[model samples]
Target: MGKSQKKRQMRRHNPVRVPDSHLPKGLEAASSSSSRKEAILPILQKMESVDPAERKWACVAVSNLIQNDPSTRRLLQGKNAVGALINRLSDSEEEVVVEAAGSLRNLCIDGGFDICAEMYNKNILTPLKSFIPKISTTLSEYLENPKTAPENAQKLVYEFADNVITILWCLSETSNKAMNAINQISLVPFLMSFLASRERLPISTVTSAAQCLYVLTDENPPAIEEVRSNAPYSACVLSIVQSREGLPQANGKNKEVADNRGLALQVLCCGILRNVSPIPPPSVAATVDVDRDIVMPTLEPVLSLISLVEASQHAQEHIAKEDAIPALEKLSLKHTPKSDHKTPSGLELERLEHKLRTVQLALEILTGVCATLPEPDFDVQDADGEATDADGDEAHEDEDMDDEPEVDMAPDNEAAVKQQSGSNATIFQTLVAPLLTLIQPTPLSFPPLNGPSPHPPTTSALSAIHVSALECLNNIFLSFRGAKIDAPRADPDSGRRIWDSVWQALGAVGTDIDNPGQERRRATWEIGVGVLWGVAEAHVKVLMQLCDAATDEGVKVKCIGTLECLAQHPGSVDANRVCTYFSQRVPEPLLQAVSALIDIYSDETLPYDTNFRQGRFLDALVGSVEGVRKAVRGIDRKKERELRVRGEEVRDNLVAFIEYRRSLGV
Candidate 1:
């Protein structure tokens, strides 16, 4: 054939060129070369075909392509594959519907919050609301007569239920409208049915249901009330948490995998329990059966998850380091390769990520408990009229020279001391210390270039953990009335250790603390002279630094609030002195911090999608700034006047915003 004819023939033999309209904007030029996305265009087109079998096949293909494949999910999403699959949910074919829902479910997992939000915006919930009752009815039929359908058909029904429930659950996480729709459909009881009959259902189906219920009940009053009112549902979730009966049976190597799955389910159940029940007051805690049976049991599994994740990371780091060493070095050390010392597989990494998420959720729940649990009513004063320490009265001779002498536990209050120790032990061991660990960064072993690197816990994930831990500690501090220690020579300390650790954990990001030689005064001071300053002085520096440097609004809010709290409530004589130190040492401390907060509160560029959330955050900033203004009164009278004037301006602006939002009925 002639060259021109051969070129035309080759063009015909070449893959059919996808139209520019099918590709995401700006990718039209690259479409001729057949991008990863264009490769899937035919499948997407087939999803819209008149043939039901082709549509079903296309949907299944999309599901399989996106399953555990985040990169492909993103490509497909950019190509409007999500919209196509969402449209397929309302397709005439049953198999098409199932495959479409399955694809959406995987997108929710692999694509995470952004895709879930996209799906919600595309009105996925409208179809999902319809699917909920249908799936529920299908499952009901299966439960009523399992043998009526062929076994494969029965499995399909379960798959459909699982996929739909999971998509609903994932969507509920992203938007309030989706959550309300889910609640309107009475999804809570349907979810509980799966958990109630977990053994009879596929583990995937049961786990998906449990996870959906977990999300629905968090801060969702209707769903919470539904679970609360149903004794069997409550008992079933609590039992799963306590016994881990939902964990699949496995032997040898598979046991570890089974345990991870079981523990994950347990964490979800614990989260569900946490949502439905409030922490009982200390007076009722000892007597409340629910507290004893459900709430207390939740902590162990959560703590175990934290420990497991940490242990796995350490093992991985060790293996990575050993493998990184030179062969000559290994020979010199007489090292032998460990058969099991392999890099974490994708599945293991996914499990680790899940465990970290569970840790964050668990910490948040504990934070709620800390915030709501009532203060102990016991009197600190003994017969002699001297107050006692709650954290114990052990004296440290090596304590900083500026430290106050430790008080002796009140003599004749042996019973109180015992009770106090028991409670303190539990809180510190289970909650406080773990929060501290999570707040600190996980260390990574340095891997050689061109060598396989260890998959360390991500900074963003660890940062999330840090924020959660900080919030929990904040609650602990607030709930306990700001850490009152009546012991002798206590040195006016408040969150000294916590602030120091947090500062280090943050790596002092967005700060100048890491400048050369600044490490000597990393947190506070040296042993002599200025070291005599109370912990309040040191903590003020850390909080102010963090407040100024933090980008996360939540972190900034916590720091600003904590600074104000410390200024208002001086814990000791040294703390009182250090409270004044904020005025004396830090130049216009409250002024800068409050001004930053006000700026954040009023920034139109960073406006929240909902006025309510904006207003609430602004309200928090207002309270915090006002407290700091009252306590520190700026660097001096002159600076104080400036702060007051600025505050007046902020107040006016805030009032106007509130009125505007109120007028709109938001």
Candidate 2:
């Protein structure tokens, strides 16, 4: 029969599978029933073999077996596989050392901080440090003249370097001692060497090097100084960000498949630049030059990546909606348990995760870019309660230190640079709208079904993006409010426009209030309060107004909670000292609002329903009152006597309320 006739004839036969079809009849039985330790014990024994080949094979076996299998990792560790691997690092055979380092690196990654710490205690760095000079020499020779090293040898050397540097990177994250050790090894120059020849070295090697530098430089003054002072080092990092030639394109056939490694390199480079930028604004010159080079170029790609990911997410959601099985159809027919084909593959999920991480890194860079250092305190106190001298020495000198008058404007060239180099204000203004879009809840795009449905990749990604954006926005809000970055007189609307966008964005809490993701929603709201706290001098008025007008108890609680945070924090959560600039210099309206809250909570005449529960709210109220009292006490005796008088009344009312609550025991 012809093809059509055969298909019709086949349809007429039984639709079910035959008893002995070609497909596997049953699930595969366990090949071996050995327990975890029993399975790995032999391999551990082989690692100590006098034969180098056996030891190399054993190291490779340990690495392959422990690849993300945490139980296997623990079992191996119990059998002293870590020490075995460290011993192999000093083996006579080069192959053994390479495989050994590879296994240890895998342990650090799979075992996390604890394993890294254990490795450090076991002196993993002692042997790993020995490889640094070798890595530097081999990679240097290969990069300088590829012909000097054979292809296989070059690959092996690069592989060894990748593993060793990665181990150091993992250790550096564990503690200060590990970081100090990595720093002392003069690893920065070697890391810079990788960045300098990124085009020539293996991508994995370059990535490990970048990853090492990214962690090493973070909050490390020594690393930061070395990186910033070396003009060529910074240039190498900047070049990686600037050149987009080798990066994977967004419009490729597999759109979800992102070039995560390349994107990670960019994130590292951005972080390095941020590390060197002197975030608390020690001096304008130090940051301005780096910002000029870093911010604008870095921003364009960051914004573009955000837009790309968002568009991709929308497309995925639309596709998911179209593909969702209809409810009536699902009920009428028998449905099979969701198989692998029905959901995104594991690789696809990984890509989506990486993309989300890239977005987070981008937002963090912006947050760092917007941070401004607080001004220096002229009247500094020593820890021993001794007065400091004019030259900033301490010997119980009771001297009054006069504050320097604020400069209305910087030098013309410096001011020009600030305006052009994406200043904190400019960066804040540019990022606010886009970031606002991230915090709003994403609507449910798939059909609600009784049975388990395919998990969309964007669900967790969206939440992550929201939290990251909220954090970035929180920083921006504080940067502008705390910096008081003055705009020119000719442009009155600049500040107004920024604040308008801020309020409007804060109001865009999405409509999916009762969804299953309410925990994330609550977190979103908590961070929203933090953003408002950033500009509390102005936003507190709005929050109080909301508190008065809103009928929702939750809404009232949030507004009140935000006010309490504002009263305590000097500006943002970062500045939580007893008394500081924004703390001692709180707005008059905030003071009144806090005092009013204390009085309302203290009064017994008001019905219990008129006040919220006296649990966490009471604690927060007491803390806020205490914070205000501390702020008043911290003030110089010569200045601001009115706050002290107000503080005393607030304290008495707070004390009475705690006693009253205790008496009722409610």
lDDT, candidate 1, 245-312, per-residue tens: 53323221222443345656676776677677753333232233544465555543454344434645
TM-score of each: 0.56, 0.58
* RMSD vs true structure, all candidates: 18.8, 16.9
Candidate 2 lDDT over residue span 1-666, tens digit each: 000111111110011100111112222211121134455766777788888767776777776565424445665666678888898889999988887888887677555566778899989888887878877777777777889978999988888888888888878878888888888898899898888887777776787898788778877889988877776777677678767543434333233324446766876687777777653333332434555565545543454454434544654655455432222223211331211112243445445545655666566566555544332233334323445532335545234544655566768857775654346556655676567665654442221222111333344345546655777777665544444543311244544554555455445454343443244445466666676545444455555667668887567656655655554442222222211222222332335445544544454333221123312344455556656667557756557577567666656766676667657544
Which segments of model 2 are wrong by more than 4 Å?
Answer: 1-38, 51-53, 244-260, 278-288, 303-353, 373-425, 436-467, 483-529, 532-538, 543-666
* Model 1 C-alpha lDDT versus the unseen true structure: 0.53
- The C-alpha lDDT values of all candidates are 0.53, 0.57
Worst 10 residues of 1 by lDDT: 1-10
Leading candidate by TM-score: 2
